[model samples]
Target: MRSANPARHVSLPFPRAPRYGPEDQAAVRDLLHAGRLSDTSRGPAIAALEDAFADLTNTVYALSFASGTASLHGALRGVGAHPDAGVVTSPLTWISAILVAFHAGSFPVFADVEPGGVNLNPATIATAGQASAVLVTHTFGIPARMDALTAVTGVPIVEDCSHAHGARYASRPVGSWGAAGCFSLMERKPVSGGEGGVLTTNSRTVYERALTLGHHPHRLAAELTDPALRPLTSTGLGYKTRMPTVAAAIASVQLRRLADRMAASETNFARLLDVLHAHAAPITTPLVAAGSTRGWYGTPLIITEPVPNPAALFAACTAAGVPVRPLYEDWLSSPLLQDPALLHEAFPHVRHTGWRPPDPHALPNYQVARRQTLLLKVPDVPAADYMHQVGDTLATVLTQAIR
Candidate 1:
């Protein structure tokens, strides 16, 4: 093996998102020129965005929100994650999952991720004990084992498909499988606005409840089908969580091009993997379950076998200008979640949650996975043949160690 190939190394860009094209620019311009932005009603762009999302997820209703967090909160609450009720969810996910539980005034039941997986283990959800709702995030754009999860819990499942815009499980779109699905259209997600979110559901009751939680009465009055909830149209839970019309316009343009973007990413990712293997680098692709298709947000490459020092690889990659970095801290072990004292200090009225900290040793897979992760920052709209350069960069970085 060669000592180095600095001359041949590719210059790959680090993670950055919220790409805009001519179409996105044009759409935003059109919306701005129209001068019809308002919270009084679901604006035309937002309504169109909702329709696009509903079509993508195959759901009956899709409600836009100011952000993913708000959408998730609405979804959990819509499906009965209220005070004293337990919401079963993975600890190895974004804090929003747990925060949504708090937002709903519910206890969050922390469940372990499956061994050798980044998603919640179905067995753990089954054993979590009487959860009123289950919230699932397709962590890092890889779809969780939805079939197993649905099989275990009778509770309404609210999917946090923030990381997974176009990802699928069992040949079905992720957000559609659950009772309600929540998505974030953040800068870095697979499909994004500058900042926005959407909640999708089939049930009329769930949709209405979610709409009421974040949206205003004006929309509620127009859209509310349930006669009983019509009275609340005057106020609609007193919270304003609608996505800005301009953001909706930008997101709608992105949504239209989502399929093509995904296809390009898939090609780039496959070629990049081949390039890695060609050099025999000690890194593996992400783990996706059977019948699953990932949107490939940022590829979480793992290091296993032949045991090249993980730290050395990270440093070499960094020094050689490879677009890779160490994985983030484990969400499950973070003091932010474990310290109930913090919760008490922050919210005096809220007490008593199903917040059981799992034994770290028991989640051996996640511990090892997090420790071994190399976050390869793939572009949202991939550059033509850019992945080949990324492969070359990583190969050069690992040349000394992989040998």
Candidate 2:
């Protein structure tokens, strides 16, 4: 039997983001007043942040970039991806993933994701055959089966850590597992700045190439260098993708408090997941596998039972103040999918592939993705009781729809 909304007129929003502390504001102001807004003055802070981040993840090198897509471009360039050596990534990801591969002169071969909404399925990728590298995103903070993926395919792995910063699988950090790990410090990410990204790896050669692609000029940071990179300083050609010092400063402060923020969000995510799971007959709430510590980007809920109208479901969530919507509804139908002119600048490989398989995992690919799944934003961080109200409210609303 489906339960109804017992509480009348009570509104609940998920979690809200944590506010930046005075120290962060002061740091940003100092950079502003000093007139060293670019990478020159803030380079040191960004370097420090990179070092701190590397240490946190137990990796050897970390590089800061303008955005996650920029980092992706650098990662691909660093690993030597060519036009023929296509990049294999998940179709159920942000278009930025495919765009990055295109920007780096590689074709993006979209694969299907795993059942639990984690990483791209390795089997599907293996069946596709002969790709230069596999770019795996730890979707929704859940770590992909990195070990299984890497073990099966001997190709290099570039991990998209945009949503999984500080997340771990089997006690090993996500970034450390890949050849090059990329993270987003965008406004909505766990480590929010106005905009920025970071890349990490242990290989000196890969690090050198990434630095060159990211516009470091090779000699910018003496303290952070591999002896082998000394000669490349003169010949280095740089792209203007370095993160601004101001954004770097903000990310630095956020990095310091990341552990606490992750803990708080995890608590909220767990409680909400439990409540949703109790009423899982209608909605398949986000699942975290054993030995995985997730960095909840957005709490995803899959509607198992078909809804009469996805548009109506979205309206109901919005009407209830839940602010829920379908995940990337138009990703496949947008300009990139239809009108190639709209995405020509960002993605040159927009030519249609016709009826080729999108995912190797045998996962179903629907024409209108809007009807398949629903995604709800997890308040950047919400009050404890308010979090409960959100779960209760969603359970109530969904219960009504199912009935």
Best-performing candidate as measured by TM-score: 1
Candidate 1: count the clashes.
Answer: 0
Q: Give Cα-based local distance difference scores for all models.
A: 0.78, 0.71
The residue pairs found clashing in candidate 1 are none
Error of 1 at 347 (Å): 3.3
**How close to the true structure is residue 111 of candidate 2, measured as C-alpha lDDT?**
67
Q: lDDT by residue for model 2 over 1-403, one digit each (tens)?
A: 2235433223644445446779789989998888888763235777777887798678898888899888888888877776666788876677788768777776677666665454587778876556888899887677888888889767788989888888988788988888989899898787866798888999777777777665755444543366755665654556678888887888888888778778887777667667666656466644566787877676566677767777777777777766565566445445554555655545555343222323233445432233646676665453677656666777777777655
> RMSD in Å for candidate 2, one decimal?
3.7
Model 1: lDDT equals 0.78
Q: List ranges where model 1 is wrong by over 4 Å.
A: 1-9, 12-18, 306-313, 356-362, 380-385, 396-403
Candidate 2 regions exceeding 4 Å error are 1-5, 8-18, 40-42, 116-118, 218-235, 277-281, 337-372, 380-382
